[model samples]
Target chain A: QQQVKQSPQSLIVQKGGISIINCAYENTAFDYFPWYQQFPGKGPALLIAIRPDVSEKKEGRFTISFNKSAKQFSLHIMDSQPGDSATYFCAASSIKAAGNKLTFGGGTRVLVKP
Target chain B: DVKVTQSSRYLVKRTGEKVFLECVQDMDHENMFWYRQDPGLGLRLIYFSYDVKMKEKGDIPEGYSVSREKKERFSLILESASTNQTSMYLCASIPGPNTEAFFGQGTRLTVV
Candidate 1:
């Protein structure tokens, strides 16, 4: 069973527009939600993350809006740029089992056209 | 900055060959992980080590084994390489359970 499900396997957005990627989880025990960005031939890097307690968390141009009741979280990129084009992955994990057992959603490839 | 390094960027092996993939981290982190990325399946964990000489099986650990003799180095061994094992393997390390993980560039393994 896929613990986490992500939408829009591929997305195309114009530069300066907003880009959004959504993910849903079935496990209520999951407390940590993180998004990762991966470029071709490179490993994934942490982009932004949010805990269950917070409804929204923003860092610079990246924002993570989470709905605990809905069991959904989405990553919103403000003023998307061509440099932001990469594959994004949404992951969920519980603090008790967070060592390296993150449940990842199928990646979404985003293309920001300049 | 934390740095995780995989020994090889690319590797090729025969079906019956024994393969070893080595990973080293500079950050003195206590946790290390090995995951494989496929075209549509995304990243799936194979094994992880919480500390020296300690290992845990991840979701997919059927054809893999891990060894952590030192705190900084972790190794993944394939007893017998198979064509299905061909994929991009990534190594990661985290300071603690609640913290973010740093990843290596990844090693692309191709089994013939």
Candidate 2:
């Protein structure tokens, strides 16, 4: 069973628009949430991360909105650009449990049209 | 910067043959992981090691084994290669909990 679930297997947006991807987890023990971005032929890289203690965290054009009660978190890309097109994955893990291994969502492919 | 390096970018092996995928990390991380990536399936952990000679099974450990003889090197062994095992394999390393994990370029293995 997938401990974490993500939606919109794929997404398409225009330049200067906003692209959002959402993920939900069933494990309440999870405290650390991170988003990874992967371009074709490359490994996933850390985009941004947040803890349940915070409702939201933003880094430049990327933002992570977390809802502890809802057990969901979403990634929003502002001014979506073609350079931002890639596969995005949301992951959750507990620092004190299970070696802190990340449980990743199915992943969402994002495309930005120029 | 942390760097994780896989032995190969691509490999082709015959069914029933033994295959070894090697990964090395330069950051001297205490945690290392092996994961397989498949379309729509995301990344599935095959095995992880917290320290030398200490390993744990991830969500998917069947048909796979691991060895961490040194803190910097983690090896994944396929006792008997199968077509079903063909996929993109990624190696990651993290200093510890709540730390960022760095991934390698990935090795695409194909079992014929």
Report the lDDT tens digits of candidate 1 across residue range B31-104: 99999998657788999989899899998999999999999999999999999999999999988765698999
Best by DockQ: 2
Give me the runs in candidate 2 sitting further than 4 Å from their true place.
none
Clashes of each: 0, 0
Off by over 4 Å in 1: A98-100
**Residue lDDT tens for model 2, A1-114:** 999999889999999999999999999999899999999999999999999989999999999999999999999999999999999999988988766798899999999999
For model 2, state the Cα shift of residue B3 in Å.
0.6
Candidate 2 chain A least-lDDT 10 residues:
A91-100
Which model scores highest in lDDT? 2
lDDT of residue A8 for candidate 1: 79
